[model samples]
Target: MKLQKLIILFFFILIGFAGISQNIMEPKDLIPANDEIVNWQLIDSVNTYTDEDLYMYINGGADLYLEYGFNKLGSCKYRNRLASKIILEVYQMKNDAGAFGVFTINSSGKGKKIEIGNEAVQYDYYLHFWKQNYYVRCASTVKSEGVIDTLQQLAKQVASKIELPGKKPELFVLFNKTGYPFKQVKYFKGQVALANIFNFSHGSVAGFNEGISGKLDDKMVFVFSYENEKQRREWFASLKGKMNMSMLFDQYTTVEDGFTVKDRMGIMLSFKPVGKYILAIKGMDWPEAQPVFEKTSTNLP
Candidate 1:
């Protein structure tokens, strides 16, 4: 009888560990349980998607997620007694950097920054954040009573369920030095996002690996990173060649290891290539942007 009881206890311990593992491994488990949030109930089963079929769900936006190294997605809907509906989406990216990249692009820069997860932003009808390798969004569809509050509540619950913490990319340090607000920064790896930032119109020159764009004191700063010095030089040469030949740019001038040009909009821009990164500042002359250029260049990884 003693031996049988011991065996039974061991079996239950194994089961307990398996359950914990399941909760950690499944992204869908990030959804708030019906009892987790007050008065809001999950309306249906969580929907899961992978890289192979994510397009069926998000359509045109799938490419953007894929560009950020998408892994899988889990989403669900919730309803409250007042008939308000909230949709929750948890995107599991390949890594923390990928998750942070997606969050930066998806967020509206004007949203109220919050502290629910590793980073969070709250809009009137939605709340989103990135934690660990998961990017979570909670959006309310109806403007019923307390709907916005519930949306944020639900987002917080989801964020708390995420067990690990996430770190921003290494390139973010350069932008940090410029005093750019964290919520206003954008990070990306490919042309899809690059086009949305400031269009150089030349699509992915030099095959750059990662980039950061942000605003500081009415000036726009851009940093593009390459795998090596060779690619950085190639990009610099291509951009310089374009500035010289393009009718859209004027007042092309060359400075020490860099150049300056004014676009058709008359916005003066400066560009400097240092180490494995290329730095550009819009709305600032080379002389003015040089200080910022050197500050960021000195911090390059």
Candidate 2:
């Protein structure tokens, strides 16, 4: 009986150690001391949520985090001398790519980008930034120099505490920057998101593994990478076969290996195959698109 009891005790000890090690990467070090900042005080205590549990905080948006490999969410509220309050939410995604995914989803689409963490953006009342695997948000009820300053100070402090590799996705660099700038680029991994943004072969026909889009002066540039050449050919075959029989518009002009279109209202879309990827430029002038397509094609694997 004593021997059996000893074995059970050993097993429990091992389990306890495993539990502690599992949480070693969590942002336990991000909590600010009571007097850490001069003008702000913690509303109560730093709160934490995980995965589906985040629904309590965000009724309809928790699913988006889960889709992007959300790990944990650490949040806190603060109040100032002027009775204004700020809500700070720090989301720890699975990786830098996933962090950027959530960041792009929440951004206002128009902000004066700043340099606080790896990539920081500011709005009139709040700030959102991502560093490594963390995407953080700070929203305030009041707007003033003091509010922005305090929020930034806290962000910088927390940023210093979070420890992780600061590397962005490698695929992001493949996007041609001819006329596209920082704000105009977006990376997507799932078909649902792609369909929602720009409906092409839809959620299934495209068979997209991952893709990136950038907006130029005259057109929206879309590049989709499939699993392999076989799948790419399959999807392209479907698109090409429909070129002649289908009627989404009245004007269909065949380019090198792809086709171009203009609707009754004069909207244009052009498609071309580049290596194992497909480049689709909508509202593009045929001649101007050639050089852009060639440049992007040369960069692909």
Candidate 3:
């Protein structure tokens, strides 16, 4: 009896270890299999891509994914009895922030927001969402009532398999607390995305570690964050020098801890550096921008 008890105890211990060490679900495993969803069946094996070969698959849009710390992808097709089809692509990113960043950039900001995942957007026959470190896309070739319903059903099934939860970036909360409640904000990892928002010079303050841009009340708000205060100060100094040389800005003047510049369009922009961040406001006069800047600075952690 003693020997049998020892063997059983050892088996339970191994099982516990195995459960603790289990890996996260693979991207393909999130998709529903044949009959998992009533009338839908997977058409073929899931295709996968990595950082090395994502360009081969996406071509034009691959750069943006790589910039946001893409890891791998799993893609496959689904078909119903009437031959209606849907394409499912699940992208595994480096972290939750990367997943959220990709979703933010791709969403039109006008799509109907849904609760399928941590955050999701749905269109006629398309849906995309981010949860944990995975970004999922469900698209249909043709738009029809049945296809749209199937698209949403597939999206919900995939989201349910992603057990972990994710939250918006910390900076987003800061922006909201500072009274800049932007409905649609673009989170950027580097210059590629920043340039998409507005063309700031390549070598300007474009080397930020991470940044966010959004439009509010007809003004564009930009907040750039660096790894440390020393780096931010260094970049701010370089930004001033670049602004002076570039024709994009006309009046460049030094302020208390930062500077102000005017674009050729006669829009005044003010920039202020506090802690490890550089905040800027465009299309606002000095008198108005000052109070906005002060309130944000006082609330910065």
Candidate 4:
């Protein structure tokens, strides 16, 4: 019985070691053979995990990361001779757009933008940046001399090890800019992302590879690309039938192929398909919205 127990314990130990090995990541090697400080030490280890294992690190609000095609994550932290610590978390997403999604969601405030990777927004104590499929978050709590510069240096070192597609989504650049504000443009994929912000249709079967939305004056405008023209036509056909029929029982008048459907509270919405994409201009009367949507359509590819 004692021998059997020892064997079982060894087996479990090997399994535990395997699990530990899986979390180990290698961002890069920036350590020197010796430090300037007489008794300097380093506390550094690379840890990697998947989106499913994300909850282990972050308690809540992880669904958004998963929705954006989070694939893997690598974390690196270490201390310098001066006892200053730097921490960085690198997220490898599915594609460039996915990385951009993470960057877009986390990027706030009027932080200084840098040319680090594709784009990087820097803040006082931390920074969030992305290039290709990697979104990196680096923060330094140390208020030591040159700590900020050291953090940036470490960010660049890690960023160099990563690869970049050097490309943005094709549909991402198709949004009309004639009337749309440059600062308000948003590019996204997946239906949930749309419903959360665009609210175009709930659980619409349409699968969009990518889409863009922006403000056209006081009204909101959106452009979505389908897999192909066939898919686009199918969704449009189904949408047209419901829209045309919905206006029948309400205060709606057909204009510009689409109709002015008024809600019970009397809010009007206008939507029209331009080329392979759809155009929607909401929060304005049909008579005034018709010309704007038409003008907006001219800018669509």
Candidate 5:
């Protein structure tokens, strides 16, 4: 009876140890160091490589935030002695957040690795022909099992297609009639569009005024049109529930014969207070007014 009890206790202890080992990620599972083509050097931190180091190596860049406990990891280089065919990355897991992890291969021939922890997640990988004269990195949480693989594959694809541009894009600002700044806008000539930030005001509004005839998503816009007194009153009434109180206009005025029309000449000005800003929209259309309404609704002080 004593011998049987001892045996049962030993069996339970062995099972518990197995369970613990399975839960704990192993070094081999993190990064496979045995591959001949791929070489990995575990470094202490990310700052180990300097600008000079990056300049010296043709295929060298740093992979940071690997492993759950590790705050950061250092630079890595892939030497294509034969020819540069593929880009690879090797990383390690750091902390419980699973935000930091290494990139490596597995026995199933999968070409990526992830470090998942309780709080954070990280992606470490290499690119084939990266531009921008700096190492590219994307940091986010490890929310799923295949996230690492997805990121690694994306990095590979981006690196392969990267071409260094000759010059960078320029920035431009747009203003409304009242001269209040708008926070969100988009500018486009044809199919190519660029996002921008703009603000609105009471009488005058400014935004990306050009290439705004069509629809947009989550954008702020301003429009100017001609309307008669009655038409303008109806338009203002239509905006009652849609207008944000905090951004409503303080006052408005109407002008008779203000502009030339075939049969009639009249104009109206509707002013609304937009916190520190204000806005005036003439001949508001549903599509065009939507952005303005949204911006005012979520107005930022």
Candidate 6:
């Protein structure tokens, strides 16, 4: 009887160790020397009950919880406790540009936070890792304090594991000379979106709208739809009388199909007051002034 009892106790102990073995560390758990580029340091480890909640304290006295399954705690701190119930999965990834290394993180939990000062806001981060890349994405209102540094370290670790693909080159430029200094803007789809910088100057800005309409800053002033030369000539004749001297150039350059590089007829009218100009040149190199004029007469614009 005594021998049997001892055997049963040993069996239960072995089973318990086996259940937690995956979360336990060994000498090999230390990142290999070559992987040192990631610079990950082990912070802490805990074997909480599978259903227990993890708490995190946020900046503005807010509390959060991580719903759990299998969780590994690191040196990173959270503002609220994490509840164990919501974690769906966790994994890793590698960078393709030889930038970062492998790191471990978690995912799929309810995100909550509170606002800090006007400048310092609170945010939540979702941790994920792939073969050679480690990404911590902001999923809530809180922001990560040292995100760039963490990524840099991870990049070094996975440098050798990255496999970058081929890339194509593209060019983009913005043309704005509306008296107001042209602020830098981005191109999305085929449209240009402008923002007012709240400057005191007030001479209206102008630009082509769609392909058939013209807009004067915030107002829509004219819409044209001329299909033939006779109709275009009549439209121009009528427009010439209504337009201000400054807008005459734009009117002359505007055509049924839109402005073209071959047409330079509008250049004389388009030149600005201070001699500063916006020229749309299309070619490997700029063409001489005479060719520009000849092409302008032959082209529609």
TM-score of each: 0.85, 0.78, 0.86, 0.66, 0.22, 0.20
Ranking by TM-score: 3, 1, 2, 4, 5, 6
lDDT (tens digit, per residue) of candidate 2 on 7-41: 99999999999864553356535756558877888
lDDT of 5 by residue, 101-194 (tens): 1111111112233322211123333221112221233322224444445445434433333233111112112232223454332222211121
Tens-place lDDT per residue, model 6, 1-301, is: 9999999999999998985454233212222232242333322331221112223312321111111111222122112233111111211111211101111112212222222111111224333332212122222223445543343343233222322221111111112222222222121111111112111012222221111111223321111223444644544443333333433233334433223222133222221111111122222112232233233223223
Residue 97 displacement (Å), model 6:
15
lDDT of candidate 1? 0.83
Give the Cα error of residue 109 in candidate 6, in Å.
Answer: 32
Tens digit of lDDT per residue, candidate 1, span 45-141? 8999998689888967788899999889998988877777888999998888999999998876888988888998888888889998889888899
- Model 2 spans with C-alpha error above 4 angstroms: 1-24, 176-183, 191-206, 237-254, 262-265
Of candidate 6, the 10-residue stretch with the lowest lDDT total is 96-105
Q: CA lDDT, every prediction?
A: 0.83, 0.74, 0.83, 0.65, 0.30, 0.25
| Superior by TM-score: candidate 4 or candidate 6 | 4
lDDT of 3 by residue, 1-301 (tens): 9999999999999998875335357887887888777788889788889886898888597888889999999999988888988999999888888899899888877799988889989988899999988899999988888777788888889888887777678876677787766757888898777777766656587668888777886788888989899999888888889988887787888877777888878888888888888998888766778877777666667
What is candidate 3's local distance difference test score?
Answer: 0.83
Our model 2 lands, by Cα RMSD against the true structure, at: 7.1
Q: How far is candidate 6 from the true structure (C-alpha RMSD, Å)?
A: 21.9
Candidate 1: regions farther than 4 A off: 1-24, 178-183, 202-206, 245-251
Which one wins on TM-score? 3
